[model samples]
Structures are given as structure tokens and as C-alpha cells.
Target: FVHYIAKEMTALPVGARVRIEGLVKAKEHNAKRGTVSRASAPEGRVGVKLDDGGAVLAVRPENLERIDDGRGGTRGKGGEGSNQAGESSSLPPPKKKPSSLEPKQRTLKRDNAILREFDGSPDPNLLVLYYHFRDNAFDCFNSSEYHAQMIRYYESGLSVRLVVPRKIGNNDYFLVGLRHSREDKNALCEVAFNCKRSFSGISMLVKQRCFVCHRAGAPHCSGGCRCACYCPGGCEERGRTDHGRLCRLVRESDVTVEEECMQLL
Candidate 1:
């Protein structure tokens, strides 16, 4: 944001002790110039001490150019004695910092959209497609047909169902499914995680009430699989089919989420 003024540039190297300029009759007038007192001058010039005068004088790079190096050579713009024989090497480039704000903001926007479109469906498949579309904007979901398909799925409410996998650190989590009726072929609503519960093994604590009925009670785990939790009173029975499929996947997964984050396509 600060613009450096090129007109104020000075050739003298600041902080170097140097002899005063001029004074042809002075004893050190022909001697090597003293070190420059400072790099910058008050009036947009460089500060240097004369060999004989020893007083600071504001001068431009051109003024110092007249100073002989005693070997019939002149001082360079950078400074006197900068290079032994006018040979110089460029400095190393500066380092750049990588930024993560752009991607994070994009993810935040996508999450907000998901929460808005969510209709209490436990399906994770639709979410996968949604994220896929977002990450790969050039992919299939952006098309009119795909958009319609996604809209339809979002509007399906409790009828549509899909399984999703989430990796948190080294642990993997699947959304808990719930069924409310014996005739229900799949779970409709996802069980919410209890944030207050103690975190054990990348644990996602189940909501105190049933994921389906919202009943107030302790939850029951289905088939010993940690992925599905329900009310033993009856919600567990309704989710048996849908939750069974998820449980089977979790059982068969040879790699734990703790090992690596997987893209569940």
C-alpha cells in the first residue's frame, strides 16, 4: 500500500564512514572517500562525509558517480565498492505465503446451502452429489437435468435415503438412521449428534431422544454397529432395513477413517 518514490532514490550507502567530497588542496582530498554516514538524505539525497570536510552532504547517485575509485573506475549506483570488479549477483527472491481463506469461505457457503435445503432426510448420497457438484463445478451436477434431479431429491423429504461416510481425524462416522414403522423400508431422518457427550473414539454422541420419534430416553445401538442408534421401544425396528445396509458397509470397511480420509463416491 505504501508507494516508494523513485525520485527520492539516493546512490550513497548509508551508515558507511567516508571522506568528504571536494577540497582539492586538503591532505585527504585525493585519498579514498570516507564511509557514507547514512544511506538516505533529508532532501531526497544520500548522506556522505567528505574525505577532508567530514561534514554530511545530501547528494544524488549521479553526484557520487563522479567520485573515482582510484583505479580510474567510478562508483556504481548501488554503492561504492559494491562489486570488486563490477561483478554482482542478484539476491534470492522473497518467499510467498499460501492462503486458505478462499476455499474455507466457499465451504462455508456450501454448508449453509445444505442446511437450508435439508428436509430431515437421513440420506447422505444426495449430499455427496451436492458436494461433488460444488468441488467439481465442471462436473455433471451443474447441468439442467442434474439440477432438477438434485432439487427433486432435496424435495423428497423423508422418502429418499442414502448413506454417507464422514472422516474426522482418524475415526470414521456414518449418519445414524431411524425408522418409525415396521412397513417402512428405509430410515427417513438422521439422528443428531449430542455435542455434550464425552468424545471417546472419534465419537458422535447420539441425541438423547430417538432419531425418528424424538422420544426422550437413552438410545439403543443396532446390531452392535456404532453407526446406528435408536429407541429400543420401536424406532430400531423401523430402521432395520436401511440401517442394516449402512452397518454392513461399516463392518466390511477394512480401512478405518482414522487411517485415511476417503472420498465415498
Candidate 2:
């Protein structure tokens, strides 16, 4: 019969302290007895070998001792060497928990007065215009200047809307509400008035309508009317006869003065 020992128990050093109070089992072994002319073998129990062959049961933990010389004293059972040290020395400190009020402090504050004025308006068109300008603070003119211009236009009975798409380029911003008509829309009117005052040159591209009229033998009608050239019949000939008939027709029509002026331009 042979006794067994655990693998961990066999790993302990010879002098290491341990508590091993447990039952002991017997073991058997065989050996040669005499060596003579005719040798005889003897068979009997010798000692016990633990299941872990590297360890012997004959040695017990009680026989161990602390060996101290110049080095540090040897550790006893469940001593400092059993638990490794210096593991977490370089680890960082735990982070602090964030406060709930921190988010509220960081939130941005909007101008409530402007918001309220826009909110109180009943017209959906007005609200849409407000959002368009409000969202594009950098692209649109400054809010103060835009509001002042809007008030002035409103008081002038123009009922005009500043319609600009969100992604309109900088050059296009000045042309909003003006490009649709070649006449008195704000952009065109501003440009024409500036040109007349010699504040800016009337470039050929900007005065394309005038150039077309001149090329079509209607030079005198350049600034007067677009219909003089753009009307149903092509402008191929120059004549007082066609001119007088167009003038009479324009005067008799029921179109508004503003629309009539645009047609003329």
C-alpha cells in the first residue's frame, strides 16, 4: 500500500514550516538481502512514497527550523513570503466621482427676449424666417442690423421677405430678394442707384439687359423696358412704329406700377 500527497505540499522547501496533522498509511517495498555464491532476495515494507514522487512522507513539517545567518531570517508558515509585495505600488489613484450640477453649469444660455418675440408670432412664415437667420449667425448680417433693416422695409409697405437659403455663399447674400426681378428688387435697385451716382461702374455683365437691347437695334430703350426686346416677337428691326405701339399697350395694361417698371427694365 502507498500513500499520496498533494502537488502543492511537495513544492514546499525542506525547512519550510507547515501543519500536516493527518492520517498516515503504510507502504511496501522490495530489496536484495545477501550477496554470496547464491544470492537471496528479501521482500518487506521499507518506507512510504507520496503520490507526488519527488516528495517523501518520512519528513514532517515539525522538523523544520528558521535558518538565520547574515541574511534575513527565514519565514515561518503563512509568512511575508507567501503573499507577494510591490504589486500595486505604481498604480494611479482612484478617480473622483463627477457631480450632477456640473452639467447645468456648463450649459449655454440663449437670449430669451429674442426667443420670446419669435415664439409669440402667429405666422409660420415669420417663424421660419426667424429660425433661418437665428441658426446662421455668422453667415447672415449681425442680428441688430438685420432687425433694423427688416423694420425699415416693413414700414415702407414693401411686404418684402428676405429669402435666403441656409448655405448661400457670401456673394449671394447681397443678391437675395433682388435676383428674381431685374428691376426694383432690393439688390438690383441698390446696384442701379449706385451706378447712376458713379459710386460703382456699370459692368457689361451686370448690365447684360442693356447690352442685349443695344445689340438688337433697340439702343434707346436700354434702361426703359425688358419687354421691348424680350417680348413675343424677336427684336430684329429698329422702328418708331413698333416702339409707339408698345408704349401705348403698356400704358393701357392693368399691371401694377412696380411690375410695369420691372417689365420695362
Candidate 3:
């Protein structure tokens, strides 16, 4: 992995006119022309300030192509002396990426624990909590932070009514009245401000059921997303098409395995 980066990277000189090329993580940066702002940054990458804006981005030299006279010309020499026009561009590409070495993995154990804990058996009141916050699973799943804070508010046990609204992002937080009181207000405000995810959502109730038939505590999980469950019989097959939609979205989600484990409980 280190060899691939070392072989491809050619440091760009400060003030060198270059065009951002190659697959930048943020798609918008590709093909954007920029001048080398700093010859080097903290990391072993060149820093370029975009021609359109003042934001300096640290990019690997391999992702940049040199512009000869401010106009698109030969491929960048990466400041390695000089090269013929298209000399660097002519080489066959190698199939290597930082992400390739560490592939994504599912968090089944945590998912199972969450589903079996809070979202316990189809209680009439709890409903499908997972569905409510499926879109922002990461945010709402951090309720643990809120729990600890609330306990500390009274410095002992305090009687308080609960309002677990399905919708967040609105200013309708239940603690607004006490958002400004000293010692009292700040604690509430701090809890609200620090924990924005109210997070937000996607937790499994204690009693999990197959998304297909709602069979209590379905034994099987959809292998693709590992989020939904299935009954022991042909339930997995029966819900293939319907579940596929959500499955693909979950698989594509950029959430890390660590985040998933934290969301448990």
C-alpha cells in the first residue's frame, strides 16, 4: 500500500499551475484548476488553492496534472524534473486504492443487541422505532449521552415527564423553558446543544421481528444490509424485492463499524 502511494506521488512545487485530476473524494474537486499554494503541507501532499475560491486543499500530486502556460497542456511532471507531453499519462493504470485494503463489514452483534433491547417486542406504544429514525440512524442512536446527562441534572432522582418525538431538527425541544437558567438552564441547554442527534435514529427494539412477516424475534438477518431480520422459513426469499431497496441503501451507507457498535444499547 505504501509502495503504491510512494511510486505514484510526485510533489508539486509551490506556485506551479496545476489542474486537479483523478478521483478526488469530493466529486466537485475533479478537473478544477488550482495553483500550488504551499509546496507541502503537514502530510506528504501538495496544497493547492482553488482558482475559483480561497480554500486550500491538500491533494496528492498524482491527482494533479500540470498546466504548461495556464492553459490545459501536457500532463504534470509532478515536479520530477521534466517529462514529455503525455509521458506520465500514457502509463497503464494500477488497480489500487486506500479503501481496497480495509473493506466494509457489517455489525450484526450490536445490531441484534439494539433490536432486542429498546425496540423490545412489538409493544403497542413503541411501534417500529427503527423505521421512524431509519433515515438518520446515526444521530438518534446516541441516546446514551442524553440519559447520563438527565440523571445528573437533578443531582439525584428528579421526576420528569418524557416526550420522545419521532421528528427532530425542529426547535421544539422539550427543554426550551429551562434553556437559560443558571446551573439549571445551562445543564439542559448543554445537553441539547452537545447532543444534536437526539440523534437522531435507527435502533432495534428488544423484540425484533422480520420486516417481512413481523414474526416475533425473527432468527435470520438480511445478509446484505444486516439491519433487517427474517423468519426461519422462506421469509427471507419472500421479502427479497421489497427488502432489496432498503438493503442497498444501508450497504451504501458510509457509517463505520465503530459507529454501529457505539449505537448499540
Higher-lDDT candidate among 2 and 3?
3
lDDT of 3 by residue, 1-265 (tens): 0011111134355666776654425658887877787777776678888888678988766456555543422334553323454245445446656453232221111133433443433432332333222353422222233323333433432323222211121111122111111222221111211112111112222124455566554653546444445775588887666555544544544432212111221
* Candidate 1 lDDT tens digits, 139-193: 1121233324433433443112223233323323343222212222221111111
The best candidate in terms of lDDT = 3
Off by over 4 Å in 3: 1-127, 130-207, 258-265
lDDT for position 183 in model 1: 26
**Candidate 1, position 55, lDDT:** 62
Evaluate all candidate structures by whole-model CA lDDT and list the values in order: 0.34, 0.25, 0.40
Per-residue accuracy of model 2 over 1-265 as CA lDDT, tens digit each: 1111121112334333222221223213111111111111133111223323434344322111112222222333443344344232344436757653221111111233443343344332221222232353312222233334434443453333221111111111111131112222222122222111111111100111211232222232432322222222343233334444443433343322221011101
Query: Can you rank all candidates by TM-score, best first?
Result: 3, 1, 2
Off by over 4 Å in 1: 1-211, 215-220, 255-265
Could you tell me how far off, in angstroms, the CA of residue 254 lies in candidate 2 after the best superposition? 21
Best by TM-score: 3
In angstroms, how far off is 103's CA in candidate 3?
A: 28
